[model samples]
Target: MRRPAFHTRLRAHASACGGSSLIEVMLAVALVAVSALGLIAAQVWTAREARAMSLRESATWIADSIAEATRTPSVGNAALNQWSAWASVLLPHGDASVGESGAVAAARVTWASVRDRPTAGDGIGPSAEPCGGVDAPAGSSCVALAFAQ
Candidate 1:
C-alpha cells in the first residue's frame, strides 16, 4: 500500500492531541458537582424557613380562636382571664407574692400542638384555677380574671 500523505499525517497528529486534558475534564466535573450541591442546600434552607413561618401563623391563629371563643355566650365563666377555645384555654396563676409580675398581665398561651402531642403533664384538660389568679394581693377578689391563647 502507498504511504499516507503529509496532510493526513498532520490531521492525525492534531486529532491525537485534540481531546480534553485529564485535569481539565476532572475540574469541569467537580464544578458541576459543587453547583448541584449548592442548589440542594438552598432548597433545604427554603423548606426550613417555610416551616417556621407556618408554625408562627398557626400559633397566632390559635390565639385568635381563643379570643373569639370568649366572645361566644357558650364560653362558661369566660373573661379576659378565662377565655376558652374549641379545644383548650390557658389560665394564669401567678404567685401573689410577686406584686408586679408582668406574666399576670399577659395571656398564658400554649400551642395547640402541645395538647395534640400529649406530653407527660399536658393535655386538653383543666389548666389552672382561672378566677383567683388575677392581680389580687392573694385574696382581694380581683374578679379572678385573665386570658389565654
Candidate 2:
C-alpha cells in the first residue's frame, strides 16, 4: 500500500480528537446544572425578600392608621378591634395590640417572618429582629408605633 502523506495523517488525528469525550460532556452538563440551580436559589431568595418587605410596609400602614385613630376623641374599643381584625386579615399570621397609659398610646402589629434567613449579620433570627424588636416572640416579626394626645 502507498504511504499516506504526513499532512493527511495529522488531519486524521485532529479529526479523531475534535469531539468532546463523554466525561468532558458530562462535566460540562454538571457545571451548567450547578449554575442553573444557583440562579434558581437567588430568584427564590429575592422573592422571599420582596414578600417580607411588603409585609413590613403593610404593618407600618396598619400601625400608623391605629395611631391616627387614637388621636381622635372617643376612639372606641370597637373601632380598635376592627382595625386589629383588618390587620390580621391583611398580613400572614398577623396580630395587632394597642395600649394606652396616660396621654400616650401605642400600637404594635406582629406577623410571621421568614425564619432561617440571615439579614445584615448571621445572628439567629436577625431578619425578624428589626421588625419584631425585643418584644418579637419566637419565629415572628413585629412593627410598633406610638402616638400621644
Candidate 3:
C-alpha cells in the first residue's frame, strides 16, 4: 500500500485539530469573562469602602472641630449650632452634639450611611457602636472624642 501524500496527511491532521481550537477559544473567552467579572466586583467593593472611609473621616473632622470649640468658653451655642449645620451639609442626615460630665467633656458627630440605611449600621464591619460606649442611632455611624477640662 502507498502512503498518503503530505498534503492529505496535513488535511487530516487539520480536521482533527480544528475542534480543539474552537474549544480552546471558548475556554479562553470564559476565563476572560470570569476575570472581568471578578475585577468589576473588586472595583465596586473598593468604591464602597472609599465612600465609607470618606464619611468616617468627615465625621472625625466634625467631632474634632466640636471638641476644639468646647475648649473655649467664648465659643457658645451659636458656634455649636454653626458646626452642627456644617455637619449636616457635609454628611447625609448629619448631626452633632456635645455632652459634659464632671471634669470630662465629649463631642459626638453622627450621620446616616447611605449604604447602611436598610441595615441600620455599618454593614462592612462587626456590629458595634462607633461612639465608644454610646449606641449610635439606627442606620447611623458616629465619632466621639472626650477631653478633660
Candidate 4:
C-alpha cells in the first residue's frame, strides 16, 4: 500500500477525536447535573430560611404586642394576666387576613419571665389588635394583654 500523507493521518486523528468522546461527554453531563443539583439545594435552603425568618419576626411582634398589651389595665380584657410567670400561651387570635385560619399564637417570653411579677391580669390574647390589613404591616399581628400590678 502507498504511504499515507501526513495530512491524511492528521485528518484521521481529528475525526477520531472529533465531537465529545464518551468519557468527556459523560463528565460534562455529570458536571452539569451536579451544578443543577447544587442550585436546587440552594433554592430550597433559601425558601426554608425565608419561612423561618417570617416565623421569627412574627414571634418578636407577638412579644412586643404582649408588652404593649400588658401596659394597659384591660389589655385583651385579661389576656396578658399570665405575664407575671414565664409562660407561653397560644390562642386563635389576630386577623384572618393572614389566612382564613384566623389563628394567633401567643407565648410567654419565657417561663422565668412569667414569674417575674406575680401581679397580673392576663396574658396577651387573640384578636387583641387588628392585623393583616393595609393599615397593618404584613406578617404582623398585634394583641392586647390585660396586666396590672
The TM-score leader among the candidates is 3
Which digits, one per residue and each the tens of the lDDT, describe model 1 over residues 1-149?
77669878988887887666776899999999999999999998788677656644543454454445554546623543343342133222221111113433332333222122334356543343243343223211112224432
- In order, the Cα lDDT scores of the candidates are 0.44, 0.78, 0.82, 0.45
lDDT of 2 at 5: 100
Among all windows of 10 consecutive residues in model 4, the one with the lowest summed lDDT is: 110-119
* Deviation (Å) of 112 in candidate 4: 21
Query: How would you encode candidate 2's per-residue C-alpha lDDT over 48-105 as one tens digit per residue?
Result: 8899899999999988888877677688566678788988899988988786667776
The clash tally of candidate 4 reads: 26
The local lDDT score (0 to 100) that residue 86 gets in candidate 1 is 24
Tens-digit lDDT string for candidate 3 (1-149): 77669978899999989689889999999999999999999999899999989988998898888888878778846777988999999999899888778888788888987653346253655555657447786667788889876
Q: What tens-digit string does per-residue lDDT give for candidate 4 at 73-147?
A: 466435444433212333222221111123343333321111122232355343222432223332233332222
- Per lDDT, the best of the predicted structures is 3
Give the Cα-based TM-score of candidate 2 against the true structure: 0.73
Q: What lDDT score goes with residue 124 in model 3? A: 59
28: Cα error in model 1, Å: 1.0
Ranking of candidates on lDDT, top first: 3, 2, 4, 1
In terms of TM-score, which candidate is stronger, 1 or 4? 4
